[model samples]
Target: MIRLVCSIVAIVLCVWKVFNWAWWKPRRLERYFRKQGIRGPPYRLIHGNVAENGAASLEAKAKPMNGFTHSIVPRVLPFLHQTVQKYGNLSIFWVGGNPRVDIMNPDLVRDVLLNKFGYFTKMKPNPVVKLFVTGLVSYNGGKWSKHRKIINPAFHHEKLKLMMPAFYTSCGELISRWNKLALEGSFELDIAPELQSLTEDVISRTLFGRNYQVGRQIFELQTEQQDLLFQSSQFAYIPGQETTATLLLWTIVLLSMHQEWQEHAREEVLRAFEKNQPDFDGLSHLKLMSMILYEVLRLYPPFPLLTRFTSKKAKLGEITFPQGVQVGLPILLIHHDRDLWGEDVGEFNPTRFSGGISKATKNKVSYFPFGWGPQICIGLQFALIEVKIALTMILQRFYFKLSPTYVHAPHAVLTLQPQHGAPIVFCKR
Candidate 1:
């Protein structure tokens, strides 16, 4: 009789747990956030807003934007854009059974990223994702700090200076290929794969200390890793190759569209190098190029969304975040926010960053292309130098414009990527 009673109690507990997870806990979180004036779309049972997100995204991606516009929050993250529009910055929305409160306000974003008290934590990555995206990104506690310490040396300024020759060689190879392709003065080519190859070679040389071409037997394994990294949409961070490649590709496309900025950047690059090979110190003189790159980063940020989850109940300013709820820092939305960036927010105006990021952001925690605070991407410095090398070399040798066949479909699969390839016509300088 006692065994029967215990078995019945166990069954009852299992049923209650399932019920709580599916229905009760979500509703409780919704009510909690709502009581504090954070309101979003009403949660609907188990699939809460997942279906809605999918349907909205499908509708948004059905066609390209009406024209060339950088206000891509509407295209890349249509569902979140709509939620923010209707529900305001601290809006609470549901992701399946999980409740996510998106922090669009810069102040809240700062607190979450700083994560001073360990209240907020990275959403544990899907196991498959952790295979390659391990190390600093995968860990949160002491392990994260330990890995960060270990990896810090690789991107130190001295290390990057040593890699300058590698940078020039990879870029020179690109110039040679484009020289052959544009023999007739102009060549229409999809520069995406070409740029990817350049960044890939740079990464190979940096990480493995040799050109990938020299050892096909080993580098073939690297190719397989590349395929896996891109194939997952739940990717928290884009690898070095994709991140830098996308930056260069978008810079080319944006510069092509806004030729005046292109002229300014080239003039600056020419003055910096002036027929001499680009060197480490010479990069500092390319101020206009820096402004253009920053502006491009603002417009087409590689990581569109910065997502985190609360590990425990915590207070931010006057508001409290409950445990089990996710916190989203929408970089795409915040970068393009009218309040933060002003009326001409959608336009490609590199001049906005003429006074550098501090002046452009007015010392706010608003501009973080590689994220901010402790967990910011470690490879940012390396990525910047790599991009500068490619841009400087390209500007010295060729002029490029968007190919007529190029489509302006910027969507986020893993990172924000061109749905169709970035086809640009390059003319010999």
Candidate 2:
């Protein structure tokens, strides 16, 4: 009899644990949000919105958009886009059982990112995802502060000036390859892989002080790890490599599509350097190129969504978020918002940044391509310098136009990337 009783007790406990974890807890959170007047998609049991999210993603990916367009909302983020349209910007949503509040308001995004209080902390990515990459971007509090301090010197203006030779060398290699490919006047080539290699080479050399041949193993591992993360439904960052590569690809694509802007940027590059190798000072003087890069970054930010968790109960603007609620700052949505960026939000006009970032956007937080405030990208200066040098060198050697076979599909895995690789016809200048 006692044995039977013990078996019954074990079964009851297992059932209760499963119920609490899968149903009870999620329902309680749903009730809390509802009570607070926050609306979201009606939560389904166990999986919540995960199944729906996956389905929507599959559908979006299957259908690629036509032509060169900056509006990636429908293709890359259909679920969130639909949610905001139906429920509103500040609505709550589910990622599995976890209740996540989507904050579209720039004020709340600023508050969350700035993170003055210790209450808001980064959402710990899944352990498998964490294994892929972890840097200062993954840290919090004192650890983050320490890492930032140590890394700051590497990206300083003086340090970047020293690294210009490394940039020039890596870009020179790319130029040589492109020249060979374009020997018969013009030739079609997929620039995405080339740019990826170039950026990886730049990072290997500049950051680790190793040549591409020596650092090739590290880059390959990182690429493999990113591919693994991309296959997983759980969102996680692969850090610098993909983001930098994606940015370069988009910048090239945008420039190719807008021939006038491409010519203008090339002119700026030539005028700045005057047939000399691009130095940090001369590259900085290329205002037109700077404007073009800024505009490209605005349209396609590396990390589309930035997530934080409430450690303790906290108030953001008017709403009070309970402890453990995930808060998502949709960076892509903010960057492309027509109200914030005017009617030309979807259009690529580098002149928008002619007066610089501060004068370009309606609000300070609206234009956070590299993120904002204390947690702004540490490698910002380094990345920009590399881009400037590569672009300067390319403009000097060749001009490129979109190949007829090129498909314009921008999607986000860890970062925004062309769904079909960026194929361009490169011609000797």
Candidate 3:
């Protein structure tokens, strides 16, 4: 009788714990936010707002974007955009059992990133993401710092200068292929896959010490590796290539849309390379290209959403957040914020960055394409150098415009990508 009663008590306690975790705690947190005068879609059960969020995402993708407008917040992040539009900027929302407080104010974002309250910590990465993406991206605190220190020298500018030949070689192959397509006057081609292939090759050669030019024999051998992942350098390749490729693609499309800017960029590239093939010194001096790239990053940043978790009670601005709550910093929304970026926030104005990023942003923590604070992307310099080399080479040969088959839909699946492939007509210059 005693043993049976003890077993029943244990079972009862377990059930109560589950109930508290799945429902009660969430409601308590929800009420706390509500008391603070914050509003959002009400949390529902264990799923929270997941079902409604999914439905909104599907609805947004029901059709491609109608017009090629730079104001892409509605299309890319529909639910969050709608939430902000309805409940104001500083609002509350739920992600599963945790309350997510969406903070749009730049000062608040800077505070969260800088972890000013000493209560926030890095969000645990998704289990599926952990399977593939490794290294500095997945770490926080001391471990991330140690890993960053280990890889720091490889991405330094001087090291990248040594890799410029590899950059030029990979870009040369891409230019060669495109030159063939353009040889027969103007040609229509989907530039997305071509750019993806170019970035993959560039990463493979410079970082992996092997390229497709090395032939299929070694490729076959690599497929049989014992303990290693697909490639040791895949950590940098996946994230870096996706960002650089998308940046270059949009740079082409945006420039095609604005021909005068394209002319300006072409002139800059020509001046930089007037003596011979591009060198590190010459590439660094291409200020106009840098402005255009920064503008592209502003308009279509790769990592659209940055989320941080509170491990303990925290405060931002005037509001106090409870433990286990996630704070969202939607990069897209902040980048498009009219109050922070002035009236032309949605418009493509590279000249805003002509005075440099600090001046352009008024020295606020506003512009962070590669992120801010201690955890900024380590491969930022590598991505920049690779893309600049490729862009400089391309502008020297071809003038491109979006093909009629092209669609202007930009959506985020982890990173921002054109919904339809970037079909473009490349005319030989």
Candidate 4:
């Protein structure tokens, strides 16, 4: 009789816990948001909007955009695009029963990212996803502070200047390989993998002071891990996941499409370091190159979405978000917004950045290619320096044009990448 009574109590306890977790909590959060006048797709129990989001993404990916265009909203984030159009700027959505508010307003995005009151914190990535990539980007509180401090010195301008030799050496090898491919006038080659190798070599040698062999092995492992993580969770965005490679490929493709700009940049590069290899000092003075890179980043930011969770009750603008609600700052959508960037938002015009980031965008917070506020990328200078050196070297050796077989399909695996590899015909200058 005692055993029977104990079993009944145990079953009751399990039922109560499940009811609270699966139904009660979600409905309560929905009510809270609804009271604030926020609207979204009605929440379904358990799965939330996962099935909807996944299905929309698959359909979008199946239909590739026809040509060179920055209208990636439909292709990259179809569900969010549709949701925003239906529900408005500050709409709530679900990620497996968790209420996530999509904060598209730049002012609100600034407030969440700045997090001056320390109420917002990074959404903890899944443990399996964390294994694939985690560093300063994943940490929070004291650990994040400590990691940033330790990593800061390595990216200092003076410290990066010392790494110029490594950059030159790696870029030189890449140029040599391209020269061999271009021996018979011009030859078509996929530059995506080559740029990946170049960046990997640069990171390995400069950051760890290791040789390319060691760096190559490290990058190979990282790529495999990233592939596994992408396969498991389609929504996850791992920082530093092939970011440099994707950026380089896009820059090359953009330049190919705009030969006039490419020529102008090459002229600037030549004038900057006439008959000499680019050094840190000389690379910094390539204003045209800098402009081109900024424009490319504006159109194709690596991490399309940046997510933060309310660690405690926090007020962003007019809304007071309850603890545990996720706030998503859709950086890509913001970058490509016509209202923010004018009608030419979709065009590749490097002149937009000729006056630098501050003068280019309507708002400073709106143009966060690397990111904004305190948690901005520590490796910004490192990545920029590497790219400048590589571009300078390539422009000196060859003039490249997009291969006819090249398809302009940009999609996000982790970072924005060409769905079909960037194939360009390289002719020795």
Q: How do the residues 1-429 of candidate 4 rate in per-residue lDDT, one tens digit apiece? A: 999999999999999888877789889988998898888888878878888988998998898686777788888888888988898888888887789999778888888888899989998879886666576667789977866776677678888888888888888888888778777988888888888777767766764466667855654455554753332221112344267777788899999999999999999988988758988788778888999999999888887888898999999888989888899888888888888889998898889998888888755578887778998887777778878888888888889999999988777776888888999989888
Cα lDDT, all candidates: 0.83, 0.80, 0.82, 0.81
Report the C-alpha lDDT of model 3 over 325-384, residue by residue, as the tens digit.
888888888888899899999899999999999998888888888888767888888888
TM-score of 3: 0.92
Which residues of candidate 1, in runs, are more than 4 Å off? 1-11, 213-238
Q: Write the per-residue lDDT of candidate 2 for residues 201-234, one digit (tens) a residue.
A: 8776875577766765554455555643232211
Ten-residue segment with the worst summed lDDT in candidate 4? 229-238
TM-scores, in order shown? 0.92, 0.92, 0.92, 0.92
TM for candidate 4 is: 0.92
lDDT of 4: 0.81
Q: Model 1: clashing residue pairs? A: none
lDDT of 3 at 207: 64
Writing each residue's lDDT as its tens digit, candidate 1 over 179-248 gives 9998888999898889878987887676656774652234445454565333221122237677899899
Off by over 4 Å in 3: 1-7, 116-118, 212-232
Ranking the candidates on lDDT from highest down gives 1, 3, 4, 2
Error (Å) of candidate 1 at residue 94 is 1.0
Which 10 residues in a row give candidate 3 its minimum summed lDDT? 224-233
